[model samples]
Target: MSFDGEQYPGVMAPPQKAQGFRLNHTMLRVKDPEKSLAFYTGIFGMRVLRRLDFEEMGFSLYFLARLDDDEAIPEEVGERTVWTFQQRGLLELTHNWGTEDQDDFAYHDGNSEPQGFGHICFSVPDLEAAIAWFDSNEVSYVKRPEQGKMKDVAFIKDVDGYWIEIVQASKMEGAGR
Candidate 1:
């Protein structure tokens, strides 16, 4: 079950003829940039790594990261704009004024369940602290810190109606399959 990456680094490398590729970021459209920024930055503690304003389009894009390092920005050149930050991973927030209808607008109504795109997850050090922060701030969560089928995993959600899965490693002893 243990992968010794260093021992078999070649196996993990790209094919000899294939170009190198890495996961740059996942972009999600937001109805309100300010509201989305507030939830991501205020509640989740993500920092605004950079901001770009599309003057002709009348929309702004902000890249936020949980990491404090600025060097994590990708060097790849393309039309896809990006914002980089450090956390468990990087989050790219893209706002396209011309393509508002293309945004992912799926949501779980009270009677219906979530389908298609599920939710974004974050690993936290303390589930209790995260839950308390959400509760105190009046943030709604689909499920509080409850025991998952596995040992110590928990979940929560943000104001923009995104679910966050929080896993506490200390509780996951032999729970790994």
Candidate 2:
């Protein structure tokens, strides 16, 4: 079906109560914090905004974001923690204790049989440059831009095997047409 504003109920008439609501973050369970952190920070250029550890629960939560060039991060831990949750487009990685030690440990990538979650997308300014960057880092690809029917889009796998959809808005002029 073609794009239609009235296709979904309540979408055409948004609720007033949800005016102030905004997406804070998306959480993903990871097997190893070090590997996941490296992929997110080193590859994706995200900064570790805040890290919360729960020794009693045997898990940890790492909040990350790709802050603006001139954005000033809070110096103190409490301030940083507060500031992190207030921002949009943040990524939270949760790691359960001892999962890294289990050689067979793996998280559902949401792209295989019995799929549930699909993928997270990143809109890059330059799709070519981003693809080259991924190549330079030897990032595994789920689909190259030219490989699929969706010529303007691409997908790459992260350290935890999660699919990351990459796109350039300008390149997708008539993507679904």
Each candidate structure's TM-score, on Cα atoms with residue i matched to residue i, is 0.66, 0.92
Pairs of residues clashing in candidate 2: none
Q: Given candidate 2, what's the lDDT at residue 36?
A: 96
Cα lDDT of model 2 overall? 0.92
Off by over 4 Å in 2: 1-7, 10-12
The alpha-carbon lDDT assigned to residue 147 of candidate 1 equals 51
